[model samples]
Target: RLERLGARFEAASPLGNGQCSAPHPLTVTALADGVALEPAATLNCRAAEALARWTTEVQVAAQKEFGESLKSLALGGTYVCRGQNHDTDAKLSEHSFANAIDVMAYGFTKRASLKVTAAPDGTPEAAFLASARTGACTFFRTVLGPGSDAAHGNHLHLDLRERNAGHRLCQ
Candidate 1:
């Protein structure tokens, strides 16, 4: 049986941090059953459909642009504290609920790889990130790579939640 990871969104709180209006936290849960399954997020049910669609697109793009040699995908950022750039109030993370995804690794089997913070910065890492960002996959509504921000120096922040419906502040 195939399983689609489902995530749920929880409104951001101000108790931890003064910022909570950004992407809400997500609560992801796994379901096991017998059925032809498809990958899915636990974001808003409506948004989940979109997220699932986009995720597949990103995978395809990665393979097509990077290579069929690509293996497991690495993650960096996911659900985090929603706020303006660099604004933190010591609150819970936006991913506290599971609304976000941080890409940190991408291995081509146990051999070739493209993992953020996995290998020291060099020509290989540079090329990996460059290709992923420029590949133009429609899976993630937004893709934040190195140079996007210092905090993102080692990974790509992939959010599959509602954007513009409110706004996208991730980088």
Candidate 2:
């Protein structure tokens, strides 16, 4: 289904066990619909689907707002078997289960890439980032970005963790 939708990916072998494990993993290298992820990323099927949709949907709006179409996504990484913020003693993060992706920047075809940050005070670029962050809540169960926390001060963290009552964490 994903391949038919123009998602370029390859299935990954299951990893780990017990508290830190990822099932049905996939290494998605690109979204053939026009969005390219820098260095690619690995994620679970559901997370990958949500990412593709979010990028596709946001790219149109981003282009209209910024006068430039997005061409690539700069990712911090995905599918790391670690606890939140890499705290070994802490609970595992959604990334540990291949259910999350960290977006550090956005590349445009006609302009320099936009770095995800809380600095520079106010600017059209910041506005666009805000809009994109808010828009992500529609597709991801958890959306953490710049102002969310120090750990997420430089990247947007999106995940597909199911919650009761369709609860969502958008910060």
Candidate 3:
């Protein structure tokens, strides 16, 4: 599906893990749906697909609501070999397995980018951000944003973590 949509990516070698590894890792540099990434990202195919879908949906929504098309996706990072909150003793984060992405901002075609922030009071950009966060819940297993926690204060954390009984964490 991602290939059909014009996403440019390459398969990566398996990475480290005692429990599991991303056998099908991918480095995505561009999206066919017209969304751009601030920096190229590497992720599991599933995570990449979900991000592409979410970006497309969010861009369309923003166009309808704010009359602006998305120019680029500001990413914090991806495919990090780290534990939750970078605590070595803590459980491994989805990022360690290439199953997560951190979005920092959304650049628009017509105006300035809308950065993710805790102080998303009442504004059109805030509303757009809220809508993107809410809509992302449908595609990702976890969606952590501004109010989720101090650790995720400035960026949106999206991941495809498997949960019991199909339960999802969307905060």
- Which numbered prediction scores highest in lDDT against the true structure? 3
The C-alpha local distance difference test score for the whole of candidate 3 amounts to 0.86
Model 1's lDDT to the true fold?
Answer: 0.46
Error of 3 at 44 (Å): 0.7
Could you tell me every candidate's TM-score relative to the true structure? 0.50, 0.92, 0.93
lDDT of the candidates, in the order given: 0.46, 0.85, 0.86
Clashing pairs in 3: none
Best by TM-score: 3
Residue range 36-121, candidate 3, lDDT tens digits: 88898889988999988888789877887789788788899788888898888998999988999999998888898888885447
Lowest lDDT sum, 10 consecutive residues, model 2, at 118-127
- Candidate 1, residue 26: Cα displacement in angstroms equals 9.2
Query: For residues 15-118, could you state the per-residue lDDT of candidate 2 as single tens digits?
Result: 77677677778889888456787887888898998998888777876777787788889999788888888898997899989899999998888888888887
Q: At residue 11, give the lDDT of candidate 1.
A: 34
Candidate RMSDs in Å, in order, are 7.3, 1.7, 1.6
Q: What tens digits encode model 1's per-residue C-alpha lDDT throughout 1-171?
A: 012433222333322333333343333332211111122233433334444444444455455555554434444444344543345554344454354556566555335665664334555555555655554235455556666777777766665445567554444
